[model samples]
Target: MTSKTIASSEPSIIESIDQLFLRFIVGKNKIYKEEEYNDGLSEAEQDDKELGLPAAEEKSGWNQRILLEVEKDRVKRVEADKRLKDKRNALLMRYFQQSLLKVVNDKLENSESVISDQLQLRENTVELLKKLLAGEPRYSVLASLLELNPGTRNRLLSLVSSEDFMKALGRDPRNVRDIQTAIGMIGTDVLRFLVPAILFKYRINAYSHHNTLFAKKLWRYEMTLGQTCTALMHDINYRRPYEGMLLSAMVNFAYVASYQQYLSSFEVVRTACLDQAREKGEKNRHDFFYDIKTDSASLQALLVSQADLKLSLALSEKLFQKSFPHLVNALKEEVEGLAYEERTTVGKILFKAVRFAKYDQLRSSRLFKPEWQDDYLADSYIEQDVFKNLLRQELFRFKPTWS
Candidate 1:
């Protein structure tokens, strides 16, 4: 047969079986040779050789490579975690910003509707004061001086004639100059009495266009504070309810000043609260929005530096020194010597009164506790029999006409 023809032909079964046996023997011999070579080493080295582990010298290199891979994975995971946390924080910030913007816009939209109501309440308060003071001859004279309405002036004049007015003034006027002097003296006293009310009225007008609800609420709060302070002062035999009134009225003067500058005061307060929260850590996080202690401290500072009340100058200075030592050096030149106990007593009562008013407002509005708890006036101090009785009486008598 030709060679091509012979190759094309199939092999016999015996020939194929022989070829398969030859391939199997060759593979088995190679494995036997490796086993025979491993037999020369000790049991541990044989196991190591079987497992294909590196020698000690090369072990470090292998470990380093493994560590490099692990480190790489750790870094990737850490970066991913950081990205996730940043995304979460950004979303939270956006939500808070939207919420704040909505609140601001709502306040603006509803301002006009509420302004007339606030004005009506203010007018009602003024009328109530007029009625309360009508019986006093001095007040009648003061009313005549301040009254712009012709009919009201005539009515007040009729109630107090020139003779009665002069007697009340404790002056026997012989000439126009004497009469003018008597009128001026009475006017000064009237102005002193009217200062709180005047401030209240001015704030109502000034803030109506800016934040009507806040203006009304602030006026109410001041009134409540003034009344409470007056009662507390009388109970403690402080003998100066008017001074208490002035002090309480001036508590939010800084806020008013801030309003004048387009709510810069709120920003200052907000920043201060945030700074305090960061310093105090998570436990005091709520303080970032409404810290009562900070409010009291700021108010005390303003009273010392800006309230301009001679009677309170010494007391305010002492309060500032005790409550805010950091400010002492800057204010030392302005501080006057005063009794520490007296200043402390005044500060406690003032702080409690403001806190109570804030709390009462929150409660009346049916607001949540956390929203106002930072400004909470602890009942621990104000719940005593003396304070409790006085607050109860004042609250009962308190009539917020504008609500």
Candidate 2:
């Protein structure tokens, strides 16, 4: 595809906002590939792909690494500021409610210029002081207190929503609500939360070919866990229609991928596993997977005797090895000395549960009518490709990852 020239006269703010808008529109899956969004494609060039142009080229490894570093540094600063949330909120309140905080206002006004200098407020401090004197509610008032312009606010919020930032905060991104709440709070602070919220949404829960949830939300979420995984494995989604088999397999791999990072309190994988076990009438997932330190032969014997329980354990191990071999090695070190039979059983069960969670491409049962068969066969290759292409496109962006 030919590259379009960005208008040189365009204001930097507009250019940045356009760039941010393009990133949001693409909804690039960062969990699979982090550098795809930072390639600096012009908005129009990206939009042209909607007209059937080829996808944009991948950025160089050096550029990708540099982009990742910049993102990391910005996230680090945002996280460091998070520890002082009470202080930041207080500062924000004081920055907008000087009339209510006369003592604070006086102190800030009389304080050394170096204090303002240290915070980089400089001349903005006077405007902030004036806004505070107007006496507005903190959250509502702060929404209008644009210390940074819209573009800068958006960029900063994106940094706040980065993977590194979430990791530093010890935030687990299992539930949509938790991710939404965190991003919402940060974004509502007159610092443009939309981009940050979108970024967080992508990270906490991405679509995958195997997630029933992902299949459910195909259109709304856009990128399947499979697509994300493929992007990570293949570097980008540049391959043509007939060349998607590798991408399909990568999607499958991501479905069973293991989690090694420190997850927050609200991950759904644990809950989903427990729910599946309960539905299947299995007693004690912990007993099936966990190794008891106490010398309890009876507990060990009971674990071995149960057929379904043993199967579940075996499934879990096999699936973990497939999805995340790296994680399996780490996990093995943590729970050593489990009986071979017990391990096999647990891996089997876990694999079955994960398999059932896969996305279903064909939502409706197959139509077996003679007329339907004739209609399907009459379509030309281009028409068939277009129909299948549209279906995949719609499926990729659906909501809740499943329905």
The alpha-carbon deviation from the true structure for residue 166 of candidate 1, after best TM-score superposition, in angstroms, is 21
| lDDT agreement with native, every candidate | 0.42, 0.31
lDDT by residue (175-244, candidate 2, tens digit) is: 2323234444443322221222232233323453223233233223223333322222232232221112
Native-to-model Cα distance after best TM-score fit, residue 320 in candidate 2, in Å: 20
Which TM-score value belongs to model 1? 0.35
Per-prediction TM-score to the true structure, in the order listed: 0.35, 0.16
Q: Model 2, poorest ten-residue lDDT window?
A: 257-266
Question: What TM-score does structure 2 among the candidates reach?
Answer: 0.16
lDDT of 1 by residue, 41-69 (tens): 45456655554444677757535445478
The C-alpha stretches of model 2 lying farther than 4 A from their native spots are 1-7, 11-87, 90-393, 397-403
Cα lDDT, model 1, residue 338: 27
Q: Which ten residues in a row have the lowest lDDT in candidate 1?
A: 21-30
Residue 278 lDDT (model 2): 70
